[model samples]
Target chain A: MQVFELIIGKLLPYATLVILIVGLLYRLNRWQRAAVGNIALYPSAATRWRLFGKVLSEVTLFSSFRQENQALWKRTWPFHVSLFLILLGHTRLITDWPLRVGLGLSEGTVNAISAWGGGICGVVALMTCLLLLARRFGIQRVREISTGEDYGVLILLLFILLTGNAMRFFTHYDIAEIQQYFRTLFSTAPTQVPHDPLVLLHFLMVQLLLIYFPFGKFLHVPGVFYSKTLLAKDY
Target chain B: MEGHVQVNETELQTVIDQVKAIKNGPRVLQLYMDICAHCGVCAEQCHVARTMPESRTNPAARSDHIRQLYKRYGSTWGQVLKAIGAARDITEDEVAVWQRDFYECSGCRRCAKFCPFGIDNSILTRKGRAVVHALGKSPFMMSETQRISDETGNDEGQTYAAFVEACRFLCEEVKDDWDIDVEIPIDRKGADILFIPASADLVSFPETHMGVAVFFKALEIHDGTTWTMASTAFDGANFGLFTGDDPHMARKNQAAYDACIDLGVKKLVIGECGHAYRIAKRMGPTASHFGNPFETTNIFLLADEYLQKGVLKFDKRKVDEIITYHDPCNFARSTNVFEEPRRLLSAMTDNFVEMTPNRTENWCCGGGGGLAVMDGAEKVEMIDGTFLDYRMKVGKMKVDQIMATGANYCAAPCANCKRQLMQLMEHYETGVKIGGVFDILGNAIVLEETKVKAGAKVAS
Candidate 1:
């Protein structure tokens, strides 16, 4: 178990970084090629700005959401909102000053916030998974378009969020130790990593998400914003 | 009629065989099959939805109705599960409604602009219409219109002599109104422009035709000619556009071009009909029916150029009422002549306000794409009234816009749009007078001796 943990712990971040960068660039290149012939004539800067505004509104606020299917929107809104909070909660991993200045909370309070955010994200993610699965299996229109990759992506996301919540709330992993290890890796210290099974499991699950994100429909997380702006509207 | 009722099985087989043998038939069919997301944006944008609120006969609904056929074909597992013995049958009732529903649409393509997946419902509607035509189950209105076009040269049964007389009457009206003895020359060789007004404009909507005559007289450009072909080709309103009869469309277009070739005119200036303009500008030049490329200038473009170059001057005082312009779908969306008409309107009247979703996103007038001429009273619930719901919504939206400005007039260049606008205004009790853009311009034209004010405002 130690050997397995050591190998995975060292290799995961590098793999994730590579997948995120290379996959995004490759997909964008393919999209650009496909879109070149279909460009609208006489596009203006104002139109571009309006499209950007619409994308921002759709992603951040779900402004197009109405009361027609409140149940679907309820599940979707919580999933997206919790995911955003969890992402924001992880800012300490990127930069310490943001958490120190912006959050202005004690270490315990920050850690507690992270744990609660992760738990909420995990619950919403599971609900989203169930809803999406139900939609794929239940609705004829959705089922007709859905492929194996869609199911795979949803299952993978659910697994990641569930593992993250487990590591945060149940196992009570050492947050300081995990942060120190990452900080050392960034600073090129190459110290011997501490043995924490939940942390190791969390890192592995994140690596799996990164590896799968590029090739699957999870690409739509970013893709929808681009398509909404570029294809649908006159912009 | 009894002898001609024989089924041409060979012809039917040929069409079916051709349809099946198309290079991307499976792909196109699958694209049409799989591409509906049903966001209802199309229904919201459709004029039919607004006009016929109770029935909800929008393009999106029409597409869904057609897709039920594919669903019946067992394309999906769920559909296959639902397909029992009697459920799979395509009934005569289904064919009848499809014929009625399909003919009621004007094929405006406005629904495509607002569709989330960019699935063109109009194309699917056309395909359905084509299938109906193949089955020899086309609506009587479509068949009768096709017959008229095939026999007479125009959809209206006006002969060559009557067409010339109509032109003479328009000239006489111009003489009476403007005191200008304008010669609306017919069959004149080497004329610069060949004016082809829609048969509706010549008959029921003479004011639109008179507006064109008055504008011509004011411009003093005596180099235009009209054809004497009052038969099927002269109508310019192609009913085949609504019915999706390509062969019939080809025949109608060929006759018009043949007349133009025989007359030896320099340019074919198709008059104030949206579909006619689209046909002349886009379809006629490329199609095999027109038989080789002939140089033609769109009359809309010509009018714009002449007005811009100071060749035509209009008095703002004559058209001193608040007005708004409704961009016809064919002229505004299909072709790119939105700005030209707006510029002319702005020059003619200071009170010209644009309707909501103007220019490329403008609503259809509900009469375009052959809906105006389809005279089936049985399908009136589906076609004109229900089909125009979205247009009525758009018209109501326009009415609100006009009311806010207190505009007394609404100007549209297309004769069909003008007709529909009149109906919409009357139905809503808006009391707004509808006229062609040139009609307002004809009223506003400044004589050469008149004093010009640089920026004088005309009060309502």
Candidate 2:
């Protein structure tokens, strides 16, 4: 158990951070190298600001999908939004007290957010992620494109979410111990880790996921920014 | 499959190399390959996808056929990963399917309209066609047209004497039919505008040539403009766009450039061939050998400008029928000449109506991407069925659009659109009279009061 904690809770986090950065750089470099000239699409100069507004709105609103298919945007929009909420909830780990003071919220308000709001966010993410995974199996047209790699990537994400929710709802974690442990892992100095089985398992899943990020469908996250129309100047 | 393409291993390597070395397309090519969510939004926009069940005209499927190749061979990691089912390999029999699918696309770019990312699969399809062409495996008709253009400098292989004879014959027809003595000046130096239209216009659709002559006559009196057609480089349609052969496109464009230099014209005007207009105005300047030093304008845009400035007068009653315009894919989407044609249409008729989705969002006539000249009306490639049937199937959506408009006349400006559209009207018995936009211009142009004095001034 200690050895598993040492590997997942202590060493793998930093190793995966290096892997994540290097993997991202390698994939980004491949894209840069493969990109032809300015094969982008945009409206005329009169509405050039629309392009920026469009990319921003698409990430936030899924307006493009709405225009094409109403039902699709319904599922896809919430899936992405829930993922975002879960990410925001995780900011609680890095520095909650400082952010709480900055926002002028009381400790009781912070505790309610940490316990209730974060729980709701995780559950929503869990539901949306499961539905999104099930979607590939539900539709035949989508199934044609869904590879083992695509499913494998999603399965990994689902595991990360499952372990995260386990820690969030069932397993009790020491907040100060966990915060100090992350600070150690991120900083030059190394220290002992919070050894909750669910927390360690969640951390290990995320570490493996980070290492495998660029080799699979996860590239689509960064890829949306480089989508053809987003970079285009004319139709 | 016949004369040129038996693609050996070395030839395969060269063709694949050309695809991997895409310098002209954007960096979004990678994004295009990766970003498709397979939402299939573009399927409805594609006329083929709507009409043909056998072809699987789904834009994503069409894109994937090429993207599969890019994924399989585009990179080393892709090649290695493909073995373990990360991506799949494109097999030999699939090459035939790839060629057919690429050719079947019509390269309309309508799919890009619905694509959330603006991933124009036509761009990728053209690249696919380019690689196929590099392997000498483009559709036989496309390669034949390019060869004719290469050897004889025009689509028909119309010799210098034959071209002169045709021009003189058309001039006689104009004088007899319209009672207007119009001479198609050939190789006239220092003309203000050089007109280069598709060569097939002279013989197949003489009315279009007659229309241009009348429009030019009005322009002569009103705008004081002088124009001439070069005998050697008269055809404007570059088969390079269809076959996806860039060198051929550049070389053919150079022929027109040489003609412009030979005439020393102030501007170059592309006649009503949509793809040709796109090539000359958009790609020709840079793809051209001698740089474009003067202005390049679509004839419709120029005519609209003349009409707006009161330089040309049209007797609207002469074109009295209810008119609806078929926006050529190249003109409407790629080149931005849609408004000018509509503006000119309004000038010539009171009954001009817009089809449900007009302009950039318009449906293609299925004759685009060099398909019209394939003339499925006569021949189908390797398929067992008739090519005319193939054309009709793809053209079914366009036929529906025009039929819904209930317009008696469709002014299809591009010759390619006109040919395929004429077939649609005939097969469907839609009773829609299809002609060039200039055909309407010729019918309604008031030339009795017009004189050639503008030409005399420009000549001086």
The numbered model that scores best in DockQ is 2
**B266-363 per-residue lDDT for model 2 (tens digits):** 78888888888778866765232235676777798888888788776678878778899988888877777767888888988889998988886788
lDDT of 1 by residue, B154-270 (tens): 777788888878878877786678655545656666555567777878887777777776665544432322333223245777767667787887777777787677666556767
Docking class of 1: incorrect
DockQ of each: 0.05, 0.40
| Interface root mean square deviation per prediction | 8.9, 3.8
Alpha carbon lDDT of each predicted model: 0.61, 0.75
Candidate 2 TM-score over all chains jointly? 0.89
What lDDT would candidate 1 get against the real structure? 0.61
Docking class of 2: acceptable
> Candidate 2: what lDDT?
0.75
Cα displacement (Å) at residue A103, model 2: 4.2
DockQ, prediction 2: 0.40
lDDT of 2 at B420: 93
Per-model TM against the reference: 0.64, 0.89
